[model samples]
Target: MIDATRPSAPPRRILVVDDDAGMRDSLEDLLSAAGWTVTTFGRAATALAKLPEVNPDVVLADVRMPGMSGLELLRELAKPEMPPVVLISAHGDIPMAVTAVQEGAYSFVEKPYEPHRLLSIVQHAADQFRMAADTKRLRARLASLSGLDRVLLGQTEEIRTLRQDVLDLAESEAPVLLVGETGTGKELVARALHDLGARPGGPFVAINCATLEQDRFEMEMFGAKDGPRGFLGEADRGSLFLDEICSCPERVQAKLLRAIETGTFNPVGADSGASSDFRLISASNLEPEKAVREGLLRADVFYRINTFVLRLPPLRQRLEDLPLLYSHFLDEFAAVYEIEPPQTSHEDMAALLAHDWPGNVRELRHVAERHVLAARRGRGSAAEAMSNDQQRSEFPGTLREAVAAFEREMVGRAIRAHSGRMDAAAEALGIGRRTLNEKIVKLGLDKDNWL
Candidate 1:
């Protein structure tokens, strides 16, 4: 068995074949320096005879040999139980090396190679092999948990379509862009994509572009010289979700574009680039086109991400799903608070549905959690009474009456603060002077008798 902990196993029992004794010693020495257990053979047959006993991780054989050419030796070790074989050849034997790799050889190295180059390739291959094993184990674990129980609550046609779109995109390798109001569960959509994707075994790395400083955003997304893996690298062989992508600076967007195009990037001060394989998913509350027009987002970057788009309908547009979402949040909070779920009165539901949820689902969830916790402590009825009283105090009996009352209060305050200067009041209230004049006239605020 290979000593897995070894910095490098001499390919476990590398079989290096060469007619020249000096060349064999050179190869063995080089591999040994890299922590590989080197076994040199003067002839290919000798190496073949010891293959079963050696159980090598890799076999390095010269393409041109005296008896039993490297091709022939490769054929013998090509069995399913055999380890990967790397063929070494001279400059003029390029064709043979190409053929070797094409025929299932792990890789080929030319003579007089740089030691670092060879080691890098070998390390990459080893890492890939290890990742393959890890992916298999992860798939089994994920398969057990793959079910609809994890699906977020919503059954409206719009939500059903969004869920279906998420499911479809998860199975593909295309980039996804989610556009919605804040708190509409963009991250949830990204996660659903990951769960449905092929590389579910890998990590789900997320970065909020809006949260990072403009100067530090690039390093945060791509990584700094000595910091933790950047969002891109962290999600290697996994999924990366960039939230509020429109907020990323132009420089950061350029770097992200390169990474997406080439599947490679470097740390802030790194001298060399590192390759990564990650699926990209981005979300933004602002419209990308409008952002580009406003010079907040780059147009080129927008095109790259305009691929598969998923738009989450705001709470107002999906009012039909409110009852289901409300129940889900209530149940969740009930579980957390260790209390019986509070029932929503018909009037309560009507009020909730009527209000424009400026904060979207997040606001609803917060309200539900508060209610559940309050109910657990027997303050639920008091909280409801207070809320009702507050609403009654602020709101009129009818919509038209409510609008008139709100308008009168706002106009009265503006007029008083500006000392009745309509122009100044208009400017202060962010309305055109003409609009303010009309409002004053329509509300009869200009009546001298009232003044």
Candidate 2:
């Protein structure tokens, strides 16, 4: 089995800086024979000047030198694009070699170089350097991309088709029903429909039926007595997005169907409420047909909202997008926290691609967030950290535990994404205000940590 812990790729290139003509020649001959492309320099200044052209994966320089010693050269190359530098030193220069290593030097080699050990160190250093370089490239690509290409990112056919559908459907006011499994970005698609639709300037009122208590469903959807208008009223001349529509009570679903048919709703304590001229958008984690068959949704209501159904592909269905999405999330979170983006090894990426990602994009997002935190702490590979999380999420001992675990993740993500604002997070998550507060206490979700 591949260890998947250490890098597997052979060293590609090295930059050798040594004053002695004989030493540089010997090192070049040795590394070249071992499948490495080598570039040598007699002075650190010359090597530093031509660093861009060289672009070596790793650097080998002698610690003791006349001017601009290897230690000084290491400091000069300490910028973001700097490759790993391994300092070659004699026994007497070991102290300086230690300091150089502490100051970002990859490693040190004593005067009598053991060829195998030197090669091993160089290989690891190049791996680290290449990893960082890859992250920079991903960031550059992400920054260059624009519009929906940036928002709904992926090169897969599924994603490409989905983006096209979003654009096509956005031009119309026809009711759109987004059907997909959880974590498949149904709400995102709903928002995109409204944002690109004709009434983009109008209000976008979203409601989550699953989070609304049965008793208050009518008041919440219609209007409260002697209070502000409900979500229906708020969505006048705009878009109203209903998430988890199948979760609403059957009686309310009938009224909702009427409201859609009449384009108006009556408020509690008011003889007549202002007419609502809003385009309806609905989403369900379950398939519309399945929800209707299971009696969770009204057949008439489902048929009405299914004027143009858009299905979101799950993460597993578009496995090719994992690397791109993972790197993109890393860049996003890093930028949010004002930190440098982290990189993953080929092995780590392979492990990620192999996983089924049952939680879909949401699961991947959480994993990316974890890797960013790991990078901030200067920790090891992300794959190791993900093992425990995978076990907890993928193989729970009980159904109740599994449900609780998922709620914690979802609620916590909502809070964090909304910067710890309960109202905002509740709205985003489709959880009721009181339910969200109760969830915070029961689940021990701290707003401070999310903030």
For 292-409, candidate 2 gives per-residue lDDT tens digits of 7546678999889999988888888888888898889889888987789887899889889888876788878887888887788887555865675776667778987788778888
Per-candidate TM equals: 0.53, 0.55
Report the lDDT tens digits of candidate 1 across residue range 198-246. 8878999887776666567677777877776777888989998988887
lDDT of each: 0.74, 0.81
Model 2, total clashes: 0
- Top TM-score prediction, candidate number: 2
**Over 4 Å off, model 1:** 1-152, 381-451
Question: Residue 85: error of model 2 in Å?
Answer: 59
